[model samples]
Target: MLHLENLSFSVHNNGDSKQIISDINLDIKRGKLYGITGPNGGGKTTLAKVIMGILTHTAGHIYLDGEDISDKNITERANLGIAYAFQQPPRFKGLTVEDLVKIAQPKLSNLSVRKRMRDVGLCPEDYLDRDMGSGLSGGEMKRIEILQVLARNAKLAIFDEPEAGVDLWTIQRLVDIIVGKYQNNPEAAAVLITHNRNILPICDEIVVIEEGRIKHHGHRDEIWPIIRDDIVCQVQDTCRGEEII
Candidate 1:
């Protein structure tokens, strides 16, 4: 439902330009779980930010559902049903899960909230009234963050490494939500930037980003073995960023 055409982004400092994303042409479809992996600073996160309008692209266009959104701001993009889940969820010590969900989707009912909480392996009875203070573990916070994003009912979701700081149980829950819920829902699409081997194999497609460009992308069965070992960012000379055809 999202199309990126010849997308390129760069940064300028002291009159010197450094390219971060280069001509990244991609089509993200509904009901597909895409896994993005590459070396450090390979433009994976940058691309996600660009698509979410957090970072503007220097050239090319971004179209969502046939409408050009290249010039939309972050809030505008969010309104357009584009959601981004950061590597680290924000800490809101005084807010409860129910409060957060209400803020995310004011029209949502308590029944829907309960269902979403259960989908993420969280018990609404136990978590909805709890504070998001230091009492909540990293896994709990991450799951709640995911829940908030899901509450948006966004058509396209970009998750920047959901497995980054969570425990194995949380990671497992993420896998379950992606495999069970995300895969079954044809109304939305999700892009995940992850190096976790377990997460990679479950994706519908694997996209290898290197040197600010899409190096290789294909079905998981075809691309998994090639990147399984290299997902750790080996940074070999041959694998450095370059726009591969």
Candidate 2:
């Protein structure tokens, strides 16, 4: 399980301060898929980075499985079974897909690598031999990143917009891969940061963040109505004041 207690982070821009996250608190239970959605500039990505240790916190605490990991570095957190797939994946200049997977799972055989890629809706023969560099499309890079995470078998996986850049047909496949992975292990938990409503039904809980704080958190069914109503009202208001030519 993962817990954030009074977590806060800020940045100083030219002597002016801006808080990305403010006194946020939440608990994610084991084996559940948690979804985070909010408008842009709402600190959702910042929260994900804070949890993965990609960004240091200005204040508050992060605990993983009852142990405080607030001070741990990225490698330490990864070694502790935490994996994160960034919104924009980094490309290794010389590494091939097979090489990355091997690095993630040294003991994985060629058969296993193929299976993992297949699970993520990739063609193993074509992709495994390809270099994981600039040639691959964004969707491919995202899927490759996910393959590495799956290969690592991390207990807690944080995926930031896994569906981003992926085609609609592939998005369903990506969701299935995520669901299958977590369903395989009861103790494995996942945090899915996405804005697409298509994925909401697949999650156990949805945490709606706005302006650096958690605005709502509850079961998908319970939270969907409020979110839907708010979105509809906003759209209606925006369209009402527009004048026709």
In model 1, where do residues sit more than 4 Å from their true spots? 92-94, 123-126, 129-136, 229-245
lDDT of 1 by residue, 1-245 (tens): 99999999999999999999999999998999999998888999899989989899999999999999998999999999999887778888889989998888999999998998888888998999999766888778888888888788888988888888777766887778766656757899888899888888889999999999999899999999888656445656567876689
Q: Give the per-residue Cα lDDT of candidate 2 at 173.
A: 87
Score each candidate by Cα lDDT: 0.87, 0.89
Q: Which segments of candidate 2 are over 4 A away from where they belong?
A: 243-245
Report the lDDT tens digits of candidate 2 across residue range 126-238: 88888877799999999998888878889999899999998888889889888888843677988899988788767888999999999999998998778878778878998
TM-score of structure candidate 1: 0.86
Residue clash pairs of candidate 2: none
> How far off is residue 137 in model 2, in Å?
0.6
Each candidate's TM vs. the true structure?
A: 0.86, 0.95
Report backbone clashes per prediction.
Answer: 1, 0
